[model samples]
Target: MAARTVSFGIGFRVGGSLSLLALLAACSEPLDLDMRGLMNGGFNTADAARASTAPRPAADNRGVISYPNYQVAVARRGDTLAALAARVGLPADELARYNGVQSGDTLRAGEIIALPRRVSEPSPATGATTTGPIRPSSQIDITTLANDAIERSAPTPAAQRPTPQVGTEPIRHQVERGETAFTISRLYNVSVRSLSEWNSLDSNFSVREGQYLLIPVVTQAPAPREVAPIEPGRGSPTPQPPSASQPLPTETPAAAAATTQAATAAAAAAPPVANVGTQTAASASNAAMAFPVQGSIIREYSKGRNDGIDIAASVGTTVKAAASGQVAAITRNTDGINILVIRHPDNLLTVYTHVDNITVAKGDAVSRGQSIAKVADFEPARVHFEVRKGFDSVDPMTYLR
Candidate 1:
């Protein structure tokens, strides 16, 4: 029997092979699926680098995001604790201890690290170049957005916002007529470089009238260390008491008795001597400053949280000076709340905030318990009062009567 030879077309075979390959590819897992560090839990450096490139939560201009109770910093790719600390103007060891990490340890990009305390906020002087911090309370209101054309545009990505320095929420300053950046920085006790960086100022630092600027955050400088008081008899040399080197003639029994009786009688008749040290201490106690407001304290002093005490009072209640002093500064916060700073003797300062209807002006001499301002009509109608020694905040209760 003769067999018929069947020829297979080259194109058909090639097409069939291609179809098979396509089917296999469709059924197989995606090439983009990453199963890295799955088998041995040992990730290669290349894999780590790639993973770090993933998007991290956005930080403010200063790479900080502050919550009501705490603040955190978002790490950039290839960041280490030491590098981050230097960038934020914090001690590397301190930052490491706060996050339970070593200063040299590399951090995953976008990892959130807690801060020990606040560092400075976005300052061009410090050379920080990230967008400003995220503060929900500080966000522009809906009404303002509806009215302003610029704010109505699509929200800017966090990376593109003005850079922030590590600190508290920034003060939003509306440019006033004839106001310059230098004057504004002086007003807030910050550097002009900081102001320019925070608001993204022009090369000339020129500000237009009616423009809005973010005032750089400022933290009080650390108080100078105090020298402890010397212990009694330890400060200086004292004359030694009479020694037994010289002996006195012995007295007869009757004479000794008479002399003792006379001494006793004289001692009994003499008036008591007041201790100078005791009197000075008592005077200081009596001189404690009076409370700013007569009301229950709604909030107590908490370092890094509440620097002062909040006293609940009726609106228009007189807020008195905590101590006798000259009004050093009469300013307003970004929230439009009045802040009065008084400079007392011995480097003491008293602060009164959330006030309205200020009756006193800067450089005015005020006596303790004299009215300086009135409590504003805030929701709680409270006055926030603080006592500061130098630049450091101290517990008001320590000085309050």
Candidate 2:
């Protein structure tokens, strides 16, 4: 196909960040993306422009071109900022600021990164319009060129660039309110058919908030990155798992006390986990902690915000605790929402918010990676949660060893 070109102004929005469309401009091609930059210290964006020569907008269109809107993409394990940024013709520097990251960050696997929209403006000098990255007919598609550039200059995709063959079984994901099967599948790299069948969803797609489903991991291993935490956006992104298969009977009042004791002990002895750094106090051991969710972390927890890592789980996927702890608070707040708070022996509190239903209760303790509540198993669900030390929230990825 002929190269697509346009003219438009190129100026940063007064306060907001800008974007340059990278790939799959629209639904003609489905996008699978991840944004584990915050949690995994990775960065990747795809763009379609020559670094030195700026191009004009397509002959037909007129507005200034910038970044694309938040769209979907699948993240294979080891994907980095450079690879991702180049896929859609975006520069690494711009994406870093959007996700609160810098260079040398690896994009986390299994998380869905939402890309922002880019606007194109008309440039005055030539009295011509400025175009965003222009797509030209060439040896490689948008995704390949982006990955190549990153490897040459930044080295983000070197570790994990090759895409993996999708697994046979689509992991079951619980449906949360506000999540559609397509969105969940795109984030996890699973097909919509797989998601629908895994959850036994009907043609009409009837689903509750807390139901269980299966989804296979189509990407590589997961990456848990730690960054300087920022406050999570207050606006609840969208409207919004399962049966007790894993086995914990805290729904009843009788099991509360004993469970709490066991959970507290586990928390006290929280093993050390490794992130980009080690734990604060040598006395505290938090190594050997498993990722609560096997998938990638889409959005990480920020204090005075969700205060917990947001795992991009399918409607029926499992959500476990990062560290062992007792079920401290397990109920909804004034908003009529469901949440679970686990109190570890370390006096750290972990919260699982916006869940469909919880399996544990107050006084009941939990082990690391133990299932406490069903995530958005029914709808396109996100595990909204946090880790707090006594009353202060701390990054769980740091202590999750």
Cα lDDT tens digits for candidate 2, 17-39: 32325333543322323323323
The whole-model lDDT of each prediction reads 0.62, 0.47
Instruction: Give the Cα-based TM-score of candidate 1 against the true structure.
Output: 0.40
Give the number of the best model, judged by TM-score: 1
TM-scores across all candidates?
A: 0.40, 0.29
lDDT of 1 at 321: 82
Error of 1 at 328 (Å): 1.5
Model 1, runs deviating above 4 Å: 1-108, 113-287
- TM-score for candidate 2: 0.29
The digit string of per-residue lDDT tens for model 1 on 249-348 reads 5766897899999999999999976532111111144757887777667788875557678888789988888788887776664577666778888977
Clashes (candidate 2): 125
